[model samples]
Target: MPFYDIYSEDVRCGRGASKSGEETKTAEVFAGDEVGFVVGRSAMEPLEPHLIYHNGPGQVYLSQSTAADVREYEGDGNWFKISYHGPTNDSWWSTRDQTGMNFTIPDSTPPGQYLLRVEHLYVRYPIGTTQFYIACAQINVRPPRNGTVGAKTPSPEYMVRFPGGLAVPEYMYEWPNTRLTEYKPPGPALWTG
Candidate 1:
């Protein structure tokens, strides 16, 4: 895999193909199962403190558009529907520094095509001044074998928008007094159903 510029809104594996993606068929996992991806970081290190800090990383459901437009989902917010998040690990500084990160899809997730959005935050400046790196993986989800469709899916309340969901002043500002234990990933609450 090659390094993708964070600001370009390009699909991680697009490789200059197209920002929206080529409707390629990737992996298919059950609606409620474990999925994972390996994160790769640039060989070069950032010179600044915040740029070098690898504290928070997680995955979000970018969107569930058609087969051709699965990559249309991008950006940060409640609508992004973050499904899994890993807290800061003292052992690693960047996502690329880690391997085999995994998260589970909510059992109630709607069955469809999706773009799994993975992101890592390098907290260098202040609490709110964090930089983010994001990538997307194409996935197809099928209704469980039991043949019950939409019976265990999430409710509307589970749907959240990012910037609006995490618009609190405190969320943007982090200080030494902040309690790491009380930390919550930025976005709507996780949909555990």
Candidate 2:
């Protein structure tokens, strides 16, 4: 029940997560669905995809009866990275040629509402000019085809908050440094479930 209105939304999609996200248009998906993550791009960079849930901010996934009993999935900093696309060769990023990304909702995820989050960092200008683009889509996940649900949400060991999760060097500059053989995006590790 903390403040979910990320001011950045003001320049984009605000108003929804401002209150009790329950009012937001929640997209319904099955546990094993292939969820696509996209946030139009003007340059070649990297994007990280994540699925997040909140069970009373302290509780754990208990049952379908209480699956969606929590507030809307918004900015709680609690989330698991589903996937990420970053530099491939020195001159390009693997996601550079694509308009969006396709990711599967973890099959073992408990049935409930979640926030599908995507983050892209633009380091075209290097230091002080880099930009960060973030988008979160609200979703309600049901059980899989087998109708099985996990006893609990993935442990906090695999989860990380947003702002604090992506703590990278403020002076990160990747323009000429594009030839990265090792690229680790600025967030939590990927939790495949």
Model 2 Cα displacement at 137 (Å)?
A: 0.9
Q: Which one wins on TM-score?
A: 2
Error of 2 at 108 (Å): 0.7
**What's the lDDT of the predicted structure labeled candidate 1?**
0.51
All candidates: TM-score: 0.62, 0.64
Clash number by candidate, in order: 10, 2
lDDT of 2 by residue, 1-193 (tens): 1223223442122334436456657788888778776444334433443222110101011112223443433454466766666656655655554546677777877777666665455543323333444456667788887776562466666666534422333223433453443445654556666
**lDDT score of residue 58 within candidate 1:** 52
lDDT per residue for candidate 1 within 44-161, as digits (tens), equals 7443332323455455654565445454534232234646554444333223345536777666667776767665554433333455555667777776656564635455676653
